[model samples]
Target: MLETRSLTVRFGGQAAVDGVTCAFHRGTLTAIVGPNGAGKTTYFNLISGQLRATAGDVFLSGARITTLPASRRARRGLGRAFQLTNLFPDLSVLENVRLAVQAQAGIGLDFLGLAARHTALHDRAMAVLERVNLASRAAVPAAALSHGDQRKLEVAILLAMQPRIFMFDEPTAGMSVDEVPVILDLIEAIRQDRDRTILLVEHKMDVVRRLADRVIVLHQGRLAADGAPEDVVASAVVQEAYLGVRAGDV
Candidate 1:
């Protein structure tokens, strides 16, 4: 559903993402894995339009969107969540999600119709909160929630956008062991749909093995290995670049 053609991003003398080309098929979960400085996040930023490509193009569903801004890409069904929690710290949980729903519906700027639009937006937001298991805390301030709950709320905000393509950058980062499964399950639920395309960048090999239908390995800003999780993880090149070890040692 998403394709990048020779995408490159150069910062002064360094190329963070260098001519990397790949495709993410519909209804599949693909994991992008590599060691630090592998250009995984840079590639994501290029595709999501958070960072502009120095060269090459990004296409969503066959249409070129290399120059589209982040907001425009989001409007076209591209949704992203970062490694860190991002939300309104002071807003009630429900209000945070409600605002996302409102933005998706393009009613946030409709001051004249807000009263009529709010009721529908509230219901939609509540439904999304329920999906993320945060309905009970809908009235609580986002800052008051646990770290894991805050992460879940971020997912809820994405769900509120009703995206067709989900790009998650370490959705479970920094969570306690007990909280990991909850976030993982929520991501798995999104993957259950056969029409949505999901791209994930996760450091947890177990999570990648359990969740990804395919794996794309990056090393030094290039596509190193792209295949099944077992094959990619077992690759000598991947092991060497990612862990400085041979496959047998793994």
Candidate 2:
């Protein structure tokens, strides 16, 4: 559960996210959609502490975290996966996720201490890899995998962190038609968990339709429509802003 209160971000004379207030309920998957430059990602950055808000507040579970740094926010149960692939190309897939698991568990100091702890870490990482269907490729270097597999590795890393709230920025950004469904199915599996809250910034309408319990549409840095996917998609304002057509035309 997360809430934003009148969140605003401005760059010089332009407001990228303007006074947007919304709530993300527990166990719900919400999609944030809009055209280019709609401030969807900007809003994410603000809430995740990647970008400082010019005004307003961000709350996680009821506590205000507006001024918390990104790392602190992450430690407090916030997980983010960027649109771009970010991983150590040289590291094996298992190694990459093992590091995440170790970091989250604060096992860095004891990393070399007990063989048992090391084994535990490896088992946990391998479990996450298995969940993403990358267990077979655990020993391969991340760079050697296909682009879609690499994206799945990113999710695997986030899963290792075990955050209560997940923020995914364009999880299906670049992939072939066949690959998209695989990632979408993985996301759907995440949504099946009743204890996690997921917020996604996605462009694929089909993905949104299939996964989003609620849809929040943004236009020119402002809230355009917020409701069920079908209702929001059929809205006159959403159609005019995103489809460049009047409501009656639909």
Candidate 3:
């Protein structure tokens, strides 16, 4: 449902992503894996409209969105959750999600009513929180929640927007053993919904193996390997570049 055609991103004359071409299809979760500077995140920035590409094009459901701004992309059924938590620290969990719902509804003009006071908005926000398994923390200040909760809150905020394409950049960055299952389960549920194409940029091999239907391996800002997860995992280049050792050699 989303595609990047020979997409390249250059920063100050340094090409961070070079002629990278890939497509993310509906009903499938695609994982982008590579070395630290492999340009996975740069590719995401290009696709999400966070950073304009130096060349090539980005398309969403067949519509060219290369020049579209980030907000416009969000309005056009693209949802993104960053590696770091992006939330209103002082706002309650429910309020934070409500803000996204409000944005989706184009109700940012209303200010007199408390965000939590809108019953419909609150219900919708709660539903999103529930999807992330975070509904119980809805009344707490965002800053007071645990680190894992904060990550879930980020997912909830994106879920509130109800986008057709979800771009998650390191969704399970710093969670404890106890917290990992919760996050993984929530993501699994999202994948099972079969409603959107998910593009996940993650470092955790276990997470990627469990969640990705296909894998694309990048190395030195270029496409090095692209195929089923097992094939990519077993690839010689992928093993040397990102997987820490040669496959079957350890």
Candidate 4:
């Protein structure tokens, strides 16, 4: 559903992402994995428009969106969550999600309308919060929630937008052992929707092995390998690029 063609960027005469081309299809979750500084997040930024490409293009559903800003891209069905929570610190969790639902529905003026008049928005937001297990905390300010709950809230907001493609950068990072499964389970549920496309940039091999339909290994900002998870994860490219081990050593 999304394609990046020779997508690349540079800083100080170095290519962080170098001519990498890949297509992510509907109904499949592709995991991008590599060691630090391998340009995993940088690649995401390029696609999502946080970083402009020095060269190449990004396309969503066969339309070129290489030059669109992040917000515009988001409006066109690109949903992203980062390692750091992006939220209104002062808004109640319900308000945060309600706003997303409002934006998705293209209700520009009704944001200032009374909550009583926006019963549908309230209901939709509450339902998303419940999916992320944050319904009970709807009245709590997003800033007041625990780190794990904040992560859940972020996911809840992403769901409220109902984007066609979901991009998560390190969804489980910094989450507690007990909290990890909640996020993972939600991702699994999203994957079950055959019309949705999911892109996960994650470090944990176990998590990748468990959740990914396909795996793409990046090394020095290049597409080093791409294949089925079991095959790519077990290949020489992943062994050498990801674990820094040569095939003979294994």
Best by lDDT: 4
Give the higher-lDDT candidate: 1 or 3: 1
Task: Give stretches of model 4 more than 4 Å off.
Answer: 109-112, 245-250
Which tens-of-lDDT digit does each residue in 1-250 have in candidate 1?
8999999999997999999999999999999998877899899999989899999999999999999999999999998887788899999999999988887887656657654456988999999999888999999999999998998898889889888899898888878898888778888888999889999998888999999999998898999999999999888877788756323334
Off by over 4 Å in 1: 115-117, 245-250
Tell me model 4's lDDT, rounded to 2 decimals. Answer: 0.92
Model 2 residue 217 lDDT score: 90
lDDT tens digits, residue span 16-77, model 4? 99999999999999999988889999999999899999999999999999999998998999
TM-score of each: 0.94, 0.92, 0.92, 0.94
lDDT of 2 by residue, 1-250 (tens): 8999999999997999999999999999999988888999999999889999999999998999999999889888898888889899999999989988987887665535863457888999999999888999999999999998998899999889988898998987887787777778878888899999999998777888999999999888998899999999888887788766323334
RMSD of each: 2.5, 2.9, 2.6, 2.7
**lDDT of every model, 2 decimals:** 0.89, 0.89, 0.88, 0.92
Error of 2 at 155 (Å): 1.1
Clashing pairs in 2: none
What order do candidates take by lDDT, descending? 4, 1, 2, 3
Off by over 4 Å in 3: 110-117, 245-250
Looking at model 3, residue 31 earns an lDDT score of: 92
**Which 10 successive residues of model 3 have the least lDDT summed?**
241-250
